[model samples]
Target: MTVTEELVRKRAEHNEGEICSLEELALHQQDIEKIEFLNKNCKKLRILYLQNNLISRIENINRLKELEYLNLALNNIEIIENLEGCESLKKLELTVNFIGDLTSVENLVNLGTLEELYLIGNPCTDYTGYREYVIATLPQLKVLDGEEIGKSERITAFQNLSKHYKTILKSQEDYFYKRVCRFLSVNVQALEKVQAQQRRETFSKKLEENNGDIEKIAKEFWQEKGPYTPESRTETYEFLRLQKEQESQKAASFEETKPRRKIFFAEDGRPYNINEPKIEFKFYEEIMENEQYFVLDIAAYKNMDTSLIDCDVQTNYVRVTLRNKVFQMALPEEVHPDKSSVQRSRVTGRLLVRMPKVKSSSIIEPQNTKWKRTTGSVEKTESKDKMKGGKSNFLTVGETTASVDWRNITNAEDSRSGDLEMQKRAPVHRRKERENSPSFVDNPDVPPLE
Candidate 1:
């Protein structure tokens, strides 16, 4: 880990940039004077984390011209104006720090490339009077704290707010909308939010309807195969659901894009880590979204044997992982959030998203099985000869007919449960029905006609 990254991780946040706990580095008095020499002297620095520090004034930070992400969260920093000269700043996190007058950010208009801004955990967030002023001023600023900004985020945020009110008001008698309508604000932004609110409500209703329909056909897909208690299951899904909700809410509220990291694609057809990574994480997210709505938040240092169910819009999803003889759910997504976008963001700058960290040795278990199973299974049957282990070899999703030829099983009842299982467990984005699976003969087993 880089020295700067080490500092951020050991104290303030997790490897994913999510804040772990305030207790990690609960500074009674943040000593900024110690870092003053580093701030001015570390000319190569790009991301600066002064969060949870006792830095009352940010006037000295104007000199770090190359700084991109500046975290002044949880500090005594009273003014945002002193950050004038840091035009290169792209992300700024100022969540818990109380800056009474948000006009302090007007000087940040110079930060053209600025994308994500965290303003959560602050009193100024509730002040609606000057919100439009801030939004109107910052155009490139897409994500403010956790949500999207001026264009998309604000529009979605307001829309959600409006729908919640309108739905409650509609259910009530005539005394509601009229008495509460004025407080709903009649600005164009508010109208946009209202419109967005309608869209989300419509979407949620549609989801509820679809979920009901799915409960019928997807009975086999429902998971009842885990060693989970009511509380454990509830907690797991709740964590996952809450996590997805947070991300979805952030996505809706965000106009800014995530920072791209360098990835290395090697000639061996495997990823080779480079000093400057060539492949970026944003593309990965886009792909993951296109393929599945829920992401399995696994540990960076450990292999992921489990997963969770999270949300796509504002709802929760389940995450699952199957391996060897065991299957499990990692974490749940129903975590509650008290912070708002006008609050600070949990993370800033780019983070290296380590994949599940699987090793081939780990993939095969007992260490005794590799020799035993391979040799034993090899002699079982000629039909088995053609088949892979419990896991089948399938072609890429977009690949040709040969890949899906296994789906030629003519009867649905003919051990075709594997395909059905895939359909059941596949994430919403990844659900695919093979048209060529002729449903005639089961490849895993011989045909009755034969």
Candidate 2:
């Protein structure tokens, strides 16, 4: 039966006060859909019996400040809430109801004067050590589920609770570590594929929600996941966005700290020399008048003396050594080994080499030649005289020419017959003119005129 004014009047008559001043109200099993009328006329009421009713909420009781005893047993209530203002409450009965977890007990902890609490026949009671947990949580309770609590029981319950929580935390940590390792071990390509598929699905869902408006979807996607305000949308969305950002940051940090492996690619014919200390040097080449010149900048070896520098030059290769470093390079073309020159600059620490071009008629021969000790010497080979059948004599000033037949000048007849015949005739005329003249030619080997 629903609670009516006649029922309220009948219940008030059994109490020790008038209808308006009644301190106790037993309206159990009355199918009360609401408690609005109770707070309007029952201002002085302290004890409220709301058991076995259709009430699904524990609200609208805040105006009953002096309320001490509240019986909400055997109701359809799904959550325990909105009882914060019942400051004078000492006993609360919530037995045989739909409360599912001990999380609801947290709200009741604010009841400072509460000493008795009953939660029997609730689903939360099915959990192991639920009674101990409740007692440890609500230390002010003298009786829990009709059982009296003692000091020793409270201490034992607290110890068990601490151990249980520590075990849970450790298990969670281990599970998380294992999951991280597994995630890292998965192939990156596969993971990226999965992520792409998930993004596609999310995009499809959003497109449907926005009536396939691509522009609207794009705008929504690019919008800042948020600087959340009190008026922002669902808390779950905010939480997920923050979680995604944190995960991205963690991934970026991991990549930053991760070590990179060094890779070297070797050419088909060129193998890296492990024994050689890696040093970079500059190379230059020039060609001039049948010669090739090369200069190597070995400035890194500036600290070494000239004597410590070593070089080997060949017809088609060169090898240099300085301190602990060695460099070997193959010449691009064949060169004349006998005419090649190698020198090092003391002031600039540069290595200069000249390799003459090999003549077409000559064969290049390999020679294991080392650099000469002299710093600036150029090696060259002199060519022999080319004229055949011609004997040339060196003549000094005031020396007489040797007598010879002018007709025997076969090669000179074609090129210089007139000039030679004039020379032959002029010498005779010079002798006669000299003899007739008074002044004589003065010579150390000749007798002076008397």
Best by lDDT: 2
* Candidate 2 per-residue lDDT over residues 10-29, each given as its tens digit: 77877643667788888886
State the TM-score for model 1. 0.29
Tell me the whole-model lDDT of each prediction, alpha carbons only.
Answer: 0.46, 0.65
Model 2 C-alpha RMSD to native: 33.1
Deviating ranges (above 4 Å) for candidate 1: 1-30, 33-35, 150-450
Q: Tell me how candidate 2 scores on lDDT.
A: 0.65
Which residue runs does candidate 2 get wrong by more than 4 Å? 1-7, 15-19, 162-450
Q: What are the RMSD figures for all models against the true structure?
A: 34.1, 33.1
